[model samples]
Target: MGKGGEDYGKSEKVGFEFRDKIFPAWAKDVKECEENFQVSHEVGLSTSEVQKRLGIHGYNELEKHEGVSTLKLILDQFSDTLVRILLAAAIVSFVLAWLDGQEGGEMEITAFVEPLVIFLILIVNAIVGIWQESNAEKALEALKEIQSEHATVLRDGRKVRNLPAKELVPGDIVELRVGDKVPADMRVLSLVSSTLRVEQGSLTGESEAVSKTVRAVPEDTDIQGKKCMVFAGTTVVNGSCVCLVTQTGMKTEIGMVHSQIHEASQNEEDTPLKKKLNQFGELLTMIIGVVCALVWIINVKYFLTWEYVDGWPENFKFSFEKCTYYFEIAVALAVAAIPEGLPAVITTCLALGTRKMAQKNAIVRKLPSVETLGCTTVICSDKTGTLTTNQMAVSKLVAMGLRPGTLRSFNVEGTTYNPFDGKIEDWPVGQMDSNLQMIGKIAAVCNDAEVEKSENHYVASGMPTEAALKVLVEKMGFPGGVNSQSSSDHESILRIFPHPWISFYFSCIFFYKP
Candidate 1:
C-alpha cells in the first residue's frame, strides 16, 4: 500500500520515491490517512508489508554526524590568525639560525632558543584546545544515549513487538503509554483510553502536559496547537494511544530543530573577546615588524656612513658578517616584543575557569566562552525550569463539605515530586471526617500515577499533577496511602477523561467493584 507494488523492495525498483514526498497527516483525518497510506488502523501492517516499508524508508534516527575528528580538532587549534602568525615567526627564526650555521659562523644560542620556546607554546595551545573540544563532543554523545532506545509497534497484523526505535519506518503503528517516550513523529489514529496527554516540555518548553486527540486540526495550526500529532522525543504522561508513524529522523520536527542547531553551531562566529584579541595580535605584529625594520635600518645606516669615512674603525665596517649580526639582533627583538607566553597564559586561565564551572554543574564547550562570561552584563533566561523547580506540588487543599467562611483548608508543604517529605498542617478536622476522607479516596483511586524510589529520592512515572494529588492524599495520613485496601477494594478507576476545551478540570470515572 505504501508504494506501488506489494513488495516494498520491488517498489523501489519500480521507481517509487517516497523520501522527498511530504505527508501532512496532521492536517488530514484518521480515515484520510488510512486511505493515503493504504493501511488498516485496526490490525496495522503485516510482517511482509512492514519489511517492505522498512526497505523503502530507512531507520528512524537523528543523524549524529561523528564528533569533530580528533585530528581535525587539533589542526583547527592552529588555524587561528594569531596562532598562524606566531608559527610563521617561529619558522623565520629557525631559518635564520640555520643560515647562520651554514655561513661557517657559530650560531647564537638565543636564535635557536626563541624558536624552540615558540614551538613549545604552539604545541601546548593545540593540545589544550583539542582536549576541551573533544570532551564537549563526548558529553553531547552521552546526551544522545539518553534518548528512547526501544518502542512498541504493531506488526504482522496481530502481534505488538518491542523494537529498536531506530528501526521504525513510515506508516508503522506505534503504541504509546504512560512513562513511554515517543520514538518518532506520528499522527494520532486511535486512542485506547478516553484521552492521552503528553509532556512536550522537551519540544515546546511547556511546563504542563498537553492533551492529544484523534481529531484533525486546521492545517495552519502551529506545532504547539496540533491536537492529533505526537512528535518524537516527547514523553507520554497519561492514557494510551495508537499513532501512525508519519515522519522519522531528520524528517521529524525535533530532528529538524536539531539540524538547525547543528548548522548554527557550525557557523558560530568568534566571541567578542576572541575577536578583540585577534585584532590586538594583528596590530601588535604590525608594530613589531615596523620596530624591527627601523632597528636594522638605523644600524646598517650608521655602519655604512662610518665605512665611507677615511679613518672609520675596523670593528664598525658594514661587511656581510656585521650585517648578519645586526639582522640577528633585530630578529631577537621582534621575538621578545611578541608575547609568546600570552596565548599559553590565556589558555591556562580558560582551562581553570572551565574546571570551576564544571564544579558548579555548568559545562563550557569553548574556551573563549570563559572570557565571554566576564564581559556579560545581563542574562535573559527562561523562567519555567530555570527560575523555579519544574515539578508540581500540592500547595493547599479544601474539603468540599466545609461551611462558608469556615477555616477548613489544610496547608500542604513540599518541594519537587517526592511525596515522602511532605507536611500537612492547620487542619482542624480529624482523619475520620467523612468529606475529607471522600476527597482523599477520590484523589487516590481516580488517578493512574505511580511513584518509585530513584537513587536518592522518589520520582513520579506519570503526570506530575496527578502525582501531586496522590501525594496530598498521602500527606493527610490516609490509611495504606493512595493504594490503600479500602479504595482499591471498593472503587476501580475506569478511564481518565481530559477536558482541554475547559480551562482547568479533568474528569475521571470510578465504578464500584463488586
Candidate 2:
C-alpha cells in the first residue's frame, strides 16, 4: 500500500520516480545522523538507493497468531493444592522418620515407614515431572550458533588466515566459502559462478532467503548496495566469495539498526487467557486445599484403634501406670492434612505443557517461563519468521536506475535469480545490471557471509544485512561472479561452556583492532 493506502503497485511512477523526487535532507551523508547515533554506509549504493531498494520491515512479518505458549498451560496446571499439601506431608513424614530412628535403632523404622514411603513416592513423582520439564527447556535452546573461525583474506599478495575479522579494514580482500559465516560487510571483488542465498530478515525484516547478483546500483540507494555485503550472525544459504571487507561489527548495517528493535513494553500485557489460566490454577489450588482439609478431617475418624497398627499398643491401652499418653494429635492432624500426591500431579501437568510447546515451535527456557507464559503480560520475542510470515515475499520493488519498469508480481518465487516479466523482455537486461553490478560485487566480495541450503530453506551465516546485499544482487540479475550458496555441517566441534554469554559472544561478532 502507498502512504495513503493507495495501491501504488499499479502506478507506473512509484518505484524509482517516487524515491528520486523525495530525497530527504538529513539522509545526505554520515554527518547527518548524530555522531553518537552512528550510521552505516556502503559505497556502491547511496542512502536513497539503499532505502528505495529495500523496505523497512520487522521480522515475523508473516505468521499465524497462535494463542499461548505451552509453558503457560503447564503453569496453569501447576497449582494443585493437593500437590502443596502433599509436599508438606512429605516433609513431616521425613521428620517422623527421624523421630522414630531416635527412639530406637533400625527397629524404630517401623514408626515412620508407612508415611515415609508414601511421601517419598509422592516426592519422587514430582521430581520426575520437574526433571521432564527441565529437559524440555534444554531442548529449545539448541539453535545453531555462529562463531569467528579465522577468516581467509588476501592481505599483501597471498591468502592468509587470521583470527580477527575486525583487522580486515575496508579494502581488504576476504575469501568466503559455502559453509563460512559472514564475519563482516565487504565488497565482492571476485568469485566463481557461485550462488549465495542471503537472508536479510534482520534488515528488511524479511526472513526468507533472497537471491544475489553482482550489479551496479543508484547513487542515492540506501539498502541495495549493501545487499551483497554479508554481515555477522546470519548464515550464508550458499556460494563462496572473495570480497573486500567494507564494514565490521558495530559499524555494519545490521549493527547500527540493531537497537531499532522495538522496545519491549515495560509492563506485560494482561491477556484474558493468562488471567483465566492463573485464576483457574489458583482456584484449583484452593479447591484442593479445601478438599484435602475435609478429607483429613473425615479420615481422622477412620483411624480408630490406632494402637492396633500404630500409636499406643492395644494390650497396654489405658494401662494404669499413670503414664499419660503423649500424643499431640493436633500437630499430627496438621501434617496429615497435607495431601502428599498433589505436588506430583501439578508438576506432571507442567511437564506435559513444556513438552507440548516444544513441538509447536515455542521454546520455554526458565522454570518460571512455564508459569510466565500463562502470565506473559509482555513478551519481548525475536521477530524472525515467528510473528511475521516466515515465508518472505518481494511485496514491492523500487528500481533505482532501471527504465521505469514496474515489478508488480507478488508471487513468492524462491529461485536464486531474478524472475523475468514481459516488461523485462522488452527491456534490456543491461538496465538491471548497470544499476546493480558494482553494488553486487562490492557487497559480495566485501562480505563475511556463508550461504548454505539446510534441510529446507536457505540459511545465511553472517550478518543479515549483508545477506540482504547478496540476495539483492541475485534478484536483480547481474549474476556473473557473485553467488550466495553453500553446504552444511560437515564438521562438528564440541565445546563445554561455563556460561551462556560465551555462546552469545561466539555468535555475536565484534569489530575491533585485532
Candidate 3:
C-alpha cells in the first residue's frame, strides 16, 4: 500500500478510451490478471503523464504457429520436382528411340554420355535443395522466444510490488526501473526526477536512448518524436519510475511497427515469369504438333517412292520417308518451351521469401495472403485501440463558480499534496452562483464511491476514476462531499447520499450534469 499514505489533494489515477481496453471488472478470472498483469497507479498524474510512463506492447505470450508458411505450403503443392525428373528421363528415352530408328548402326557414345550427364545434374540439384531447407529449419529453431512467462503489477488495490509480466492488458499499470525493458506500454503517472533513457535503435534506427519526459507534443511528431513515451522492445538504459500501464501486446505502437514489417514481408513480387512459362509451353506444343502433322502428310502424299519393278532393299528404301527433321524440332521445342527446371527455381524463390518473413516476426499461414498483402488496397483500423491512447486523464476542468461558507470546511485537504501548477489566488467566495453550488453539492452527495483518511492524506478505495471524480468535487469547493456516518472521523463513507438506488450489482454515481 505505497499509495495508502500519499497525497489527498489530487490523485494520479486516470482512464483511457479504447474499444478492447477491458476494465478488468467483467473479465472472468480477473484475479489471474492481477497475478500475471502489472498495471500500477501513482498518487498524482495526468493521463498524458501515464502514457509517457507505459511502453508499447506486443505478444507477451506468442501464439504458436499452427501451420507451415504459405510458401512452404504452396511449394508443397507443386509437382515440378517430379516433372523435372520425368522430363529428363523422357529426353534420354527420345535419344535412345532416335538411335534405334537408325538402320544398321551401333549405339553412339554421344547419345549415352548426354543423357547420363543430365541425370547426374538433376540429382545434384535435388541434394543442394535439401541442404538449403535443412539450414532454414535450423535458423527457425533458434528464433527468439516471443512469449513471456510472468508479469508484475498491483493486486487488491495496492502499490505495484511485483507479479508476472505475461498477463498485461491495456489498463494494467506497471512499475519499471533502470535496465528493465518495459513489460508494457504506459504513461508516466509518477516520476521523481527519474531520467529514463531507452534505446530505440531497433525501432527507429537510432543508436541512443530517447529521453523520457512528461509534456504535450505535436501530433505530427514521428514515432521518434514523442520524447516522453517509451515503446516495447526498447531497453531502458537508466533511471526508474512508476508507470500507469496503457496498452499491452499487439495493441502497442511498437506492435504496430512489427505488424507493418510483417505486412511488408507478406507482400511479394508478381509471378509473371511463371505464368509466361506456362503459356510458352502451350504455344510450343501447338507449333510442334502442326509441324509434325505437315511433315507426315507431305511424306504420305508426295514423298512415297513406289514403283512396279524394284529389289527388296530398294523397295524398303522406297517406303514413305521418316521425318528426321521433325523429330529433332519436336525435342528442341519441348526443351525450349517447357522449362522443366523452372518450377524448381520458383519454389526456391518462395522458400527464400518464407525465410525473410520469419525474420520479421510474421509466420505466414496462408500462402496467398503474401500476395494479398502486396496487392492490398485498403486497411480497416479501429480508432479506439489502434489510433487513440485510450488513456484517460483530467486535462482540463472548468469551475462554474464556488460557494464559501455553504460548504463545511474540511481539514483533510491540508494533508494532501497541492496539485495546482499555477496556484489559484483565492478560496471559495461566500455562496457565489447558486447553479455552480448545486452542481458541486450533487456531485459530492451522490453515493457509491468513498475516500478514507489514512495516516496523512485521504486514500480512495474502489475505482481510482470514481475516487478522482470525488477529488474533482472537493477541488471545486465541496467540503468532504459528505455529511458523515461515524464519530471520531475514523470510519465513514465520505460521499454518502440518501438517494434512490440507481441499480444493484452496479458501481456508479449519478453526476446529474444535464
- The reply for model 2, stretches above 4 Å from the true place, is 1-89, 100-110, 114-144, 148-150, 161-172, 176-180, 185-197, 202-205, 210-229, 237-328, 371-384, 387-514
Candidate 1 TM-score to native: 0.74
Which regions in candidate 1 have their CA more than 4 angstroms from the true location? 1-21, 85-124, 142-147, 301-328, 352-364, 370-389, 393-447, 450-460, 468-514
Ranking by TM-score: 1, 3, 2
TM-score per candidate, in order? Answer: 0.74, 0.41, 0.42
Better of 1 and 3 by lDDT: 1
Estimate the overall C-alpha local distance difference test score of candidate 3. 0.46
Error of 2 at 137 (Å): 6.8
Go through the candidates in order and give each one's C-alpha lDDT.
0.76, 0.44, 0.46
Per-residue CA lDDT of candidate 2, range 184-250, in tens?
Answer: 5544444443455565554455545555544433434455333444555454544555554444443
Whole-model lDDT, model 2: 0.44
Count backbone overlaps in model 3: 39
Residue-level error in angstroms, candidate 3, position 508 = 49
Using lDDT as the measure, which candidate wins?
Answer: 1
- lDDT measured at residue 361 in model 2 versus the true structure, 0 to 100: 66
How should the candidates be ordered by lDDT, best one leading? 1, 3, 2
